[model samples]
Each structure stands twice: as C-alpha cells, then as structure tokens.
Target: MWYLGSWMFPVISAAMWLGMLLGMFIYWEAIGHPIYPSMDRGQTIAYISDVGAYKLKPLFIAGACVTTVFLDLGFLAERWLRHAGRLAPNTSRAQKVLSVIAILFAIAGSAGLILLSNFDTYHYPRLHDAFLLLFIGGYWFSAIFLCAEYQRLGIHYRSHHILRLSFWVKLTFIIVEFVLAVVFASTSYTGKPNVAAVFEWVVALVFTFYVLSFLLDLLPSVRTSHHQPQGWALKAEMEKAHHGGQQPGAPLTNDSAGPNQNRHVAPGDDLEAGAYRGTSMTNGPGYPAEHNDLGRQKRRGIGRLWS
Candidate 1:
C-alpha cells in the first residue's frame, strides 16, 4: 500500500501537467486563427454591434461536466476512506461545507451551460454571455474551496515552497479573470477576450508550476526525507520517561505496597517516603526516644549537683 500510494502522487501530477499544457496550446491556436481578423478598438466595437456578440457556451459546458464528475468521485473516495477509519477526525467543517457548495455549483453551472448551448432563438441574445458568467463564477468558487481544503489538510510539500505560495497567487489571478469576464459581459467590445485569454495562459502557467511542485515533492528522494525517522527526538522522550520513574536518594523497589504506604511514615521512622523526605514527631509524646538527647543531658547535670 505504501509503495502504491507513493507512486500515485507523481502519476497524477504528471497527468495534470500534460492536460494544462495541451489546454494552453489549443488556447493559443484559437487566438491566432486567421478567420477572426485582428482589428482596431473602434472596428472591434462596430463588428460586435453588427453581429451581436456570442458567448463561448460549449467551453463552459465541457468544464462544468468535468468538474461535476470529479467532485462525485472525490466524495466517493472520501466516504470510502472514512468507512475504513483512515481519515483524520479533526477535518475542518468549513472545508467539508465548501466542497459540497462547489459540487452543487458545478452541477448547476453544467445544466445552465447545456441549456444555453441547445436553446435557439429568432431574436435571442447570445447565450454565451450567461454561460460565461456561470462558468467563471462556478470555477472561481471551486478554486477557493480547493485551496481551503489544502489549508485544512496542513499540506506542506517538502520540495516546493512555491506550491504553498502560488496557491494565493493563483487565487488572485482567478479573481482577476472573473472580473475581466464580467467586464466583457457588460461591454459590447473592450478587447476583454484578448485580455482574458492572456490571463488564462497565466493561469495555465501557474497550474503547471503547481503540478510540478507536487511532482518534485513526490520524488523518492524527497519523499524519504519527508518521512525520515526522528531518532533523536524519540530517544530523548524515552530517557525522560525513564528518569521520571526513578527518584533521587530512594531505593527502587517493585513490591506490592498500599497507595498510602508512600504518603504516611511511622513516627521517628528514618526510611524516606516515596516523594516526601521530611521527619515528623510521634503523637502523644514530647519527643521520641531517639530525639530526647537534651533531656538525658539535663538529668545527668542534676545528679552531679546533688552529689
């Protein structure tokens, strides 16, 4: 099980890296296509007004579908692990709630995307606008939820500090992307798509780094370091326990003694108690015989004077 889990992390990271790279290639191709001739700001505005700008609903539909399926799989895996008593009991409540919210949003966004794609209209407004809005909103929410999960898990990838740092960085970029999308929705033409496309590329680059960091941490050398045995710490703890069991200037005995035997000592007794060492006088007497040296001296002096 250990070996398999160790291998799984790298494999998954590689897959994500490849997917992001392919996505970036396709995005670049779309932007540089000859059919959509590059135009000045005024020309671009006039073109959008004449054609009634359309949203890219198909992309949102695809993204939503993928997200929904993955979320379901994640939930199944979580439940299975819990049933096997493998999951930690201290999982954050906020993380779980956010996960559920992301799943719901993905499903709703997927439905909206599909509806907008299929619906036809004589004088209907572009459905891509609505689909884009939902797509950006759903993905933004899901990204936040995923980051929360990472924090809740206390993940600190040994090989890459950038993974931790770039989480917030990517989150900020996503927010910016969402804002750009909103701007595009409001205006007929503002070169928003080009700007959004650039942000998308930036997101892809950050995601690639994120995956690579995970991969580096998963490498055998890195993994070994992370799991290295804390021999010195363990030795120190054992020594402390051993010393705690022994007391200063006391015999180490394993005899079956009553609980109070160590608490109460016979009067004038010289044996040290378990944790108490002070002497005490016997009751119903001025002092015990062993402690009456002054009285004996006084008696001898009176005999000498009488003689």
Candidate 2:
C-alpha cells in the first residue's frame, strides 16, 4: 500500500495551503481592502462594501458552482480509476492537461474579478455566468488535482523530469502573473474602480507568498541534488588521465590536440584533428597534443552541460 502518511509531504502541503489562504484573506479583507463599495461615493470613500450587493457576486457565484460540479465529476472519475488499480499513482498526461485547464479557469476568475471591479453595470446573461461559474469551480478542482499530482510525482519520482518541469512551470507562471497584476494595477484606466485595484494588489501579494512557499518545499530537493553522492572514483580517474601525459617542466599542452591520440596529424599539426569526436589537435610550441585533446574534450563536455 502506498501510504501517503508515511511522508511529511502532506503535512507540509496542508501548512502551505493554510498559510496562503490565511494570508490572502488577511490581505484582501484587512490589509489591502480589495473589495470595493457597491457604488462610487466619491474620491474619499473607501471601497469596502458588502459582498451580497456586489454586482459581481452573481457572476462569481455562478462560475464557482458550475466549475465545482465539473471538477467533482473529474475527481470521482479519477478516484474510481485509482481504486480499481487502473491508473498509476503518478502524474500522467491527463493530470497535466487537467492542471492546465484548472490554471486557465483560475486566470479567468481573476479576469472576471478585474472586469467586475472596472465596470459598474457589467451584466451578462445567466448562460455566460454559468460558463464563468464552471471555470471558477474548476479552479478548486484543479487545485486538488495539482495536490494529488504533486504527491504522486514529488514523492514517488523525486527527480523525475515531469515533476521538475511542472514545478518550474507553475512557479514561472505565478511569478509572471504577479508581475502582470502589478502592471495592470498601475496602468489601468482612470475610471477603474478602487476595489479592483486593491484586489489585484492582494492577489499579487498572495502569489508572491505562494512562490516563496514553493521554493521552501523545493529546497530539500535542491539540497539533495547538490549534496548527492557522486562517483569520486570515476572523476579521479578522469583527472588522472588528463594529467598523466604531462611532462615535468614542459610547457602546458596547446589548447588544441586530440585527447585520445586517435587523429592523424597534418603539417604544422594545424589539420583539425578529432573533428567529429569532440577532440582537436593543433601544433604549436608549448602545446602538448594531449592537452589539446583534453581541451577539446573539455569544450565538448561544457557543451553537453548547456544541453
């Protein structure tokens, strides 16, 4: 049995989520005052207004409800597959697609909030609201999906490329969104509502915190990579081979030379040697054929590092 409790990941995840929600609530309500007054009273009136009378409530509520139902259905289906042992307890392409959709919905929700804040008479048909509501609901559902995927990928395949890619992608997107929010708040139309401005700032702050939390969670993995055991014997042997051909008091080998001695030398040793094998040989005073080869090999190794 894959006991999720065996690891502290769940506890860490719960703590992170709780912290984010609490921080967002505090900033939105008390600190940032993102919710605006129902009607513009003047330049001096604060935008704190009751949630019930807010014109955006219908759109928000409808979007939230429909998205929630769709997400629930998806969750149940996934659970069914898992329980029947038909799905692996790891991130699959399906999960990635679902996560992308969830991210889209979250972005849409944010957009809706921004739009509502800007336009006082923003009204749409119930059908349009339904679509928005569905996306809103999907946001939470997608969050759940992400949690599960993290557990499966982060814990089961700690160093997997998919896990790394997902983490970086999410982090990058969050950072970009935060930057966009700042830009939006700063450059919005003059008549934009105050509530919307506050909301954008609050969300930006929330995303900043989320990014920090993710970095914290990823710290251990980063440390493990840096400190992981490597084959010292192999590294030592390579170094030994590199220095083996050095002659005492001889000038250091030329920057170009076939390291493996497998290439034919041209006149003046200027013929490009070891072209395909990443080794190069060039003749010059103080340039050892060995060093030239090693240098070429080293250059090749550096290229591989970039790739």
lDDT of each: 0.43, 0.42
Per-residue lDDT tens digits for candidate 2, residues 54-150, read: 5334443443334333333333434443333333233477655654565555455445533432332333334343543343343434455455555
Tens-digit lDDT string for candidate 1 (1-307): 3455433443454454455345535553566632223323433222221111224334433433443344344433443332333332224577567656755664564465344434422123456446545645765665566556545543533233433553565466556656655555444355455444444445434433433332322332221434522223334445667766576444556554534455656677644344232323223256564663444446556323322
Per-model tally of clashing residue pairs:
1, 20
Q: Which candidate is the best by lDDT?
A: 1
Cα deviation at 277, candidate 1, in Å, is 10
List candidate 2 segments past 4 Å from native: 1-91, 121-139, 158-208, 211-307
Q: For candidate 2, what is the TM-score?
A: 0.27
Q: Per-residue error at 307 for model 1, in Å? A: 54
